[model samples]
Target: MLNRRHIRVKVMQSLYANLGGESEDFSKDQKFLMQSIYSMYDLYILLISIFIEVRNKGIDQIGKQKQKHLATKEDKNPNTKFVNNEILKFMGDNELILEKIKQQETIDWDLDSEYIDIIFKAIVSSNAYKSYMKTRMSNFQQDKEFITTVFREVIAPNDKLYDYIEDKNLTWLDDLPTINTTILKLLQKLRPNPTKTYLLPELYRDEDDLKFATDLFTKTLLNQNELNEEIKHKTINWDSERLASIDLVLIQMAICELKHFPSIPVKVTINEYLEIAKEYSTPKSSNFINGILDKLVKEYEADGKLNKVGRGLL
Candidate 1:
C-alpha cells in the first residue's frame, strides 16, 4: 500500500508531466498517474510470484538431472532444501495468491523463462543456496532466513530480471524500491501457520487514501494559478524562469496542501515536500524550496487563509 509520501510523489510526477509538456492533457495524465500507482501493486504480486518460479526452476533441474543416463549420486538424490523451504511452501499453498494469479493474469513468467533460468542458476551457484542445502532439518526461521538471503543476494540484484521487468513495464523502475522493501517485510513477518492465508497488502489503506490521491492531483491542477501567484509573490527576488519546473510543481503542491488540506499540519506538509524535493529535484532544491515555502507559509498564516481543523492541525 502507498503511504502519503508515495502518493505525493505520484502527484508531483503528474504535475511535472503536465507542466513539463510531457503531456498537455491534465485529465489524461492524471488517469495515467493513478494507473501507474495501481500498476505498482500488480508489480509487487508479480515479484512475489518469482519465488515460486525459481522454486519450479529448481524442481525442473533436479528432475532432468535425475533422468541423466549416467547421473551422479548427487543428481539421483538432489538436495530438496530449496524446493521445500517452509516460506515457499506456505506461499505456494496460499489460496489468496493463487486466486489473484487467476484473477489478474499479470504475472506470466513462462513466456520469460530465461529470467527464471538466470535467477535459478544464480541461486544454485550462491553460498546461501549451498549452505541451506547442507543444513539438516531446517525450521521455519531457518527457511525464512535462507529465502531472504537468496532474494537479497540473487533475485533483488539480478540484472537480467531487473532489465526484463523494467522493459515489460516502465513504471516498475520507479516502484521497484518500495515494492521490494514491502515484499521483504512481508517475507520477514511470515510464521508457520496451517491456515495458509498470508496477508497481501492492499493497493490503498481505505477510500480516504483513494480520495487523497485524486484530491491532491485535482486540487493541484485546479489551483495552479493561485498556487503560482503565491509562489511569484514570495520569490520576488528569484526569476521564475531560472527555477526548475520540478521545483515549481513541488512548491505549488506544498502550497495546495497547506491551504486545502486543513487536517495536515503545516510543518508536516513542508517537511514532506522538502524531502521529496531531495530525490526528484536538484541538489540545492531542498533549501531553495524551503526558503520560498517558509515565507509563503508565514504570509498565508498572517492572512488567515489557512482554516485548519483538529488539534495541532494549523
Candidate 2:
C-alpha cells in the first residue's frame, strides 16, 4: 500500500521532527521513524475495521427492528442484503484481519460506538444504500460495490468520523488520504474467492524499504552540517523567516538522496522532493526548491561528487 513517495514523506517527517527540537537523540529519532511507519499500517487497520463494525451494527439494527412491539411490515422484514454483504462478512470474519487488529489492540468503534451508529445512519439514508437494498440481490460483486460506495461516500467524508479519528491520533490526519486509498484499492482488487487466506497489505514493500526510512533519516541527521553548508553557500541571508521549515526539510532530504544514495537517479530524487514540497510546503515551494536543487545538482556534477550509478541515473 505504501509507495516510495510515502516512505519519502515518512523520512521527511522524521527529519522535521529531529530538527524540531523535540528530541536531540539520533537513535531515539530513528526509533520514532520506525514507529511512525508502523502507525500508517495501524491506521489502515483501524479504518478498514470500520466497515466490519458498521456492518455488525447494521445486523443489530435489523434484529432490534424485528423484536419491536409495534413492528411494521417493513420493520419485521428488514432487507438483510446490506447486513449480509459478502465482502463485509469476509472482512469481519477474516482471521488475518482479526489477528492484526488484536495485535494493535485497538477498535475505535468500541470507544465511540456513536460514531459508527452515525455512519450507519448516513449509509442507509444515502441514495447508494437505498438503491442497493431496493433490489433483492446480494452477489459478491454487488456487495463489494455497496460497501465500497458507503466507504467512499459516507464513511470517508464524514465530519464527525473525521473529527473522532483526528482526536484519537493526531498523526491520523496525515495518514487519512493514504489509508483511504489503500482501503479502496484493496476493495477494488478483491476477487470473489481468493487463493490466499487474505489479500492483506504488507507494512513495508520489502526489507530494503524498511531500511530506506532509517537510512534516509539517519543520513540526513548526521550530514546536517554538510547539507547546511551546501544550502548556505547557495542562499544568501537564509534563515527561518525566508524558508519554510518544511521546504528546508525537503531540500535537505533531496540533497541527502543525491549525495548519499547512489542508485537513485538525480531526476527522480529532485522530482520526488518537488512534489512533496508542492503538497506539504508553501505555494511557491516547488519552484523554489526546484531552483536551489537545480543549482546544487549542477555543482555536484561539476565537482564529480554526484556519481550516480544505473542506466537512467544522472
Candidate 3:
C-alpha cells in the first residue's frame, strides 16, 4: 500500500511546511513529515467515503422525486430503476471501501460535502455518461432502460470521478503529513508484531532489509544535512528555500542508502528515489533528482567511497 512516491510526497509536504514556518526545530518538522507519509491510506479512504456519500445522496434525490410523481411518457424517469438499483446498491456493497470507513473513527463523513459535489458533477459530465445515454436511446424502448443507463453510466462512474477529484485535491491536504503520522502511529501500536504473525513467510525474510532502508532514510533526512559537509555542498547548488521539502528528504534518504547500505544495490536506490520523486515532487523533479543521484553515485565510485557487498548489489 505504501509506495516510494507516497513516501516522497509526505516528505515534500513536511519540507514545505518547515520552510514556510519560521521554526528552526528539525525534530518537530521531521515528526510532522513522517506522520504525513503514514496517513496517505487514511486520506484515500476519506476521499472514497466522500464519493460514496455523494452517490448515495444523488440516488436518494431521484428516489424521492419518483415517489412524489407518476411518470409521463416524455418524463421517462430512469432514476428510479438505475439510481437505486445500480449505483447506490453497488456503493453499499463495495466491501473494500466500506471496511476502510469502518476502520476509521476520526474522519467525519459529513465533512466531505464539497469534495462529493465536485465528483458528482465530474461524473455527470464524463464521456462515459454520454455514451451510456446514447446507447440507451438507441436500444432500450422502456423508461426503465433509460433509468438503468443513466445509473450505470453516470452514477457508476462516480467512483472514477472520486479518483479524479482525489488526484487533483491538494489544498484540503494542507495538514496531510500530520494526519498521516497520527494514523501510522495508531496502526503500528495496534499491530506491533504484524510481520512475525500476519505477514507471509516470503515477506518476512526481507522485513529487516526494508526496515533498514526506511530507518536509514529517516535518519538521513533527520540528521545528514547537519552532519555531512558533502551533502551540504551538493545542496548549495539547489534552491533550498524553494525546493519541495519532500524532495529534499527523499534525496537525502536515497544518497544515504547509496553510500551506507552495502547490501542494497545502487540501481535499487536510484530507481526507488526516482519513483518517489515523480509522485512527491514537481513534474520535473524526477529527472532532476535522477541526474543528481547519478552524478553522486559516479563521484562516490570514483573516489573509492562506495563499499557495497552482497550478490546483487554493485
For candidate 3, the lDDT comes to 0.55
Clashing pairs in 1: none
Root-mean-square deviation of every model? 2.4, 2.0, 9.5
Error of 1 at 253 (Å): 0.6
Quick one: best lDDT, which candidate?
2
For 93-126, candidate 3 gives per-residue lDDT tens digits of 6675577678876466466456566656755676
1-314 in candidate 1: lDDT tens per residue?
67889889888877787773222356787788888788887888788888887878777888999999999998898778888888887777787877776576667777778888888889989999888888656988999999988888889988998898888888688788888888788777877784544547787878988898888888888878777778888876767789899999999899888888898999899999999999988999999999998888778789998788888876
lDDT at 314 for candidate 1? 60
Local lDDT at 47 for model 2: 83
Task: Kindly give the stretch of ten consecutive residues in candidate 1 with the minimal lDDT sum.
Answer: 20-29
TM-score of each: 0.92, 0.94, 0.57
Evaluated against the true structure, the overall lDDT of model 2 is 0.83
lDDT of 2 at 273: 92
The C-alpha local distance difference test score for the whole of candidate 1 amounts to 0.83
lDDT score of residue 71 within candidate 1: 99
In candidate 3, what residue range of length 10 has the lowest lDDT sum?
Answer: 196-205
